[model samples]
Each structure stands twice: as structure tokens, then as C-alpha cells.
Target: MATTEMPNWFVTQFNKRAQHIYQAKGNRLKGTVAGADRIEANEAKWRLVGKGEAKEFQRGQAATPANTGRGIVGAPLKTFQFFDEVHDYDSDRAADPNGAQEKEKIFEQGGMALGRSADREIMNVLNTGAATAGNNFIDLGTTAFDAAAAMTMCQRLQAADVPWEGQVYCPLPSLLWNQLLSAKVVNSSDHVGQDLPFVKSTDTRFWNGVNWFLLSDSFFPVPAANKFDVFLYHKEAVGHAPHTELKTYWTWLNKFTCWEVNMLSKGANVLLQQEGIVRLRAPSNTAITLN
Candidate 1:
């Protein structure tokens, strides 16, 4: 006798499909961060080094190799699990009206929510670490975000020899975004090019060696006496580890009236190289007392 219920392979296929969709659109930092698969059960590890220095060489002989030293970077993995159920009392195949498409949608949306939360946590780590480092903090006390402020941030990174070849992400809060959108240089063709017209200008999105990304207020970490904190960094600044791909399991309910589907994944974030990130703090139209 052959079984007629949903097979194990069917559930596996659904899980793979869900994972594909989740990976494609779930995380904003998917392609931006230094990512790696977690080989160990609950932890990921990597090595980091400081900038190397140059020394005077005598004639053609190779000079003594400089020791930059290395540090081990590691973080514990985490899981973001979700579950939901659909009931179809009168059917043998449970309530899969859309062939489990709705379940996949739930998984994808849940993955996105978790991804956004992780993005915020990673930003907090970077910003706080930058503050402690002392050199990477750019203060804009009670000042609006203007072209000059933008240039100052860029120039500071440049002075530190941070490469400008790749795109720089500026995750700005709505408050700061509005101020930047109203800035003259951002909308003017005079600064960008003759091809850019004010009405159809793409200057705001891509300008001054930086790509602007607007983030929600809750996601943007505002420190004490500050209105907003902007993260301007290269992709190498943060690291990501995913131990388990998005997977799902199903369980039959009493009398096959309903079924439960669970989505699970294990992952975590790390600040790989703090020097590659710059944290800019600024006050909104309202000023707060600075410490």
C-alpha cells in the first residue's frame, strides 16, 4: 500500500523555495557586508589586522617585513524562528489553498523583519565602537545636514586613506533626509552634471561619492544630545554569518483538521573592521545639551 498524504520531499521543496525568496529580498545588507557561512555550530570566527606601515629600504635589498599583527574576531550565532498554521477541516491535504504559497510569504516577510532588526543591531555596534575609537566620530551639533557637512565626512574618511572606489552608504533618518533633499547642491545640476535637470535629477540618490539610503526613525540610533546618527561606511566594516538556511517543518494536527508550519534560521552579525566605518552624529532642528 502506498501513502497518499504530503511527502517529506514536498515539505523540503517548499522550504528551499522559501529560502531562495528570503535570501533574495530579505536583508538590505545581504550584499553590503562581509558575509560567510558558519561552519561551527553556534559561532563564527575570522582574523583582522591593522593598517601596515612602510619603511625605508636600503638599495635593492628587501626591507624587513613589518608586523601589522592580527586579532581574532568571533561572534555567537542566533536563530530567528517563526511558525503559523492554516486549517482546512473538510480536506485531506490540510488547508493549502495556495499550495503553501502563503506559508512561504509568511516566511519571507518574517525573514525581512528579522533582517531589519539585525541591521539596526549591527549599526549600534558600529556607532558605539566608533565613538570609543574617538577618531571616526563626526559631530553635527544642532546643525542641519548640508553639502558642507557631507563633504566633511567624506574628506575625513579620505584623509584616513579609506578607499573611495566602492559605494559609500549613508543611512539617514527622515529628518536628516529632508534637510539633505532641500539642500541646493543636492538638487542642482551645477554640481552634478549638465545631463541632470532639477525635475528629473538623480543627484539626491547618488551624489558626492556616496549613496543615500533613508531609514526609519526607530531604526536610526540617536545618541544622547543628538537628533540622529548616520552610518557612512564601506561594505567591509560589518560581517555576517548564517549557520542555517531558511528551513521549514510541518506537523499534522488532531484528526488532520489543521497543520503547523515552522520557519527557522540561525544567523548573527559582527563589526569586522571598525576603521572602515564612520559614525556621524547630528542634532535635529531642536538642540539638546551635549555631554
Candidate 2:
């Protein structure tokens, strides 16, 4: 029997394909927050400096320097890895020329796995931050999310001195997103003018100084049964430090008579500014039925 070996170019193609899929569908919040491509150590730090205010000067007043407070926020990166094995039998079947290749299927699944893991880590950090959000958390009780509720969230963030001029983002669950669509301010033709036209159900929209995006509830860490938290924040509020981008590799295992493909990444997500984030606690099971 002749043993077949995976070509070098084939491995390269597989790696590239896996990476492309990961980038396309991996983290839904990829660009919504601050990110770093590389870090020198296991931890990444972001510098925080207080703002300085200008004071009116008199013609003869002596010049005085004001001291601004400064601090650092750090997040430690952790490795995430996923792997799949393709046995010789499976590989033979995949090469039958009648169906999709086993490697292609593995690539797709591995890419999504890498992406979801990144999202899971980021959401876990957000959930932890929300628990200690202090005045930044809003418990909606049983009330479903709506345009008014969104406005209230905006008000709270603004009160915390969070900039709202095209800097705010709200990632809504499907249920809450549907509820928002029912609001007159969102669906009413009078309010849906050309400047901010309503787009498709899947597209992000801007309204009342906040950019709204719909995200799957699976990405969020539920605080309780039938309850979930929605995060409204500025891009600067959260930080993602990636020690390594998603990478793919494969090797033929002689002992197991199988080929193993692996995907991996290293990163950390942290809430950089408590004041810049607003957490909305809402019932997860409630939703608006469209006509």
C-alpha cells in the first residue's frame, strides 16, 4: 500500500482558508472595542489620564500648572486552542470526489470555533464588569427593551460623562432588537428619514446618537435564568489585547494513523472604563411579534 502525504502547498492553503473564515465570522465585537495586535508580555496595559480644563487668565495673574491624575488598566492574556482529527479512513472517503472534503469541513468548523471562543472570553469580561458596574447598571425588571429604554441608557452614560456624539454602541439581543423595531421612533415613517434611513434587519443602524447592532444571545453570559445583560458602551470603554492572532496548523500523526488540525489564539478582554459602559438588565424570554 502506498502512503500518501499532505503537500506543503496544501497545508498552506488549508491554513489560509481557516484564517479567512475565522476573520469573517469569528468575533462579532472585533472592531467595536479597542484592540492591540501584539503585546510584549502576558499582560497588556492601557494608560488612563485625566482631562485638563482651561481657566480664564488675568493680565497680571501668575501662571500655575495643574496636576492631572493618571492610572493604568491591565488585562492578562490566555491561550485558546481547538483541534480536530481526520483519520485515514475519513480522509479516503473525503477524497472520493463525490462530496465535500473532510478538510474543508474541518476548516469551517475550526474557524468558527476560534471566533466563538474569542467572543465568549470578551463577553465573560463584560458580564463580570456589569456585576460591579455600580450606577452604570439599569435593571429593567420585566419591561421589554424599546426606544425609550435605549434613550434612558443613553442618558445614564451621558451623565457619567461618556461622549455620545457618534461614539456610543449598543449590541442588542434578537428579542430586544425586535422590541426596538416596534417602537414608533424606530419604525415610524416620519422618523425614518433619509439622513438615517432604516436598513435591512441585519444591518447596523444609527439613532439618537447611538449606533445599534444586533447580536445573538448565545454570545452573552446570562446573569440569571431568563435574564441577560445588554452592553451599551463607547469603543474606548473595552480593551482587547491579542498576543497572537488566530493561527492554524496540521500534522500527520503516525501513531494514531490520523491527521490533526489545530486552531489557536491568545488574547484578553477587559473593561477599561467603568463609566464608559452601561449595562441593561432585561428579560431574555420576552419579544415582540412582528405583523
Residue-by-residue lDDT tens digits, candidate 2, 1-291:
234556676677778888877777677676677775346578877777776778889999997675566777787888898888977677664334443378888988988887788777777767776534467888888877778888898898888888767767777878888788777667655443233122332346677878787777787667788898888888788888767867777776777777777788888888877778888998987768542
Candidate whose lDDT is highest: 2
Q: lDDT tens digits, residues 177-249, model 1?
A: 6677666667555433222112131223557876665556777776674566787777667777766756677
Model 2: CA > 4 A from native: 1-5, 56-65, 93-100, 131-134, 187-202, 289-291
What is each predicted model's overall lDDT from 0 to 1?
0.65, 0.75
Evaluate model 2: give its TM-score: 0.84
RMSD of 2: 4.1
Measured by C-alpha RMSD in angstroms, how accurate is candidate 1? 6.4
Q: After best superposition, candidate 1 residue 119: deviation in angstroms?
A: 2.0
TM-score of each: 0.75, 0.84
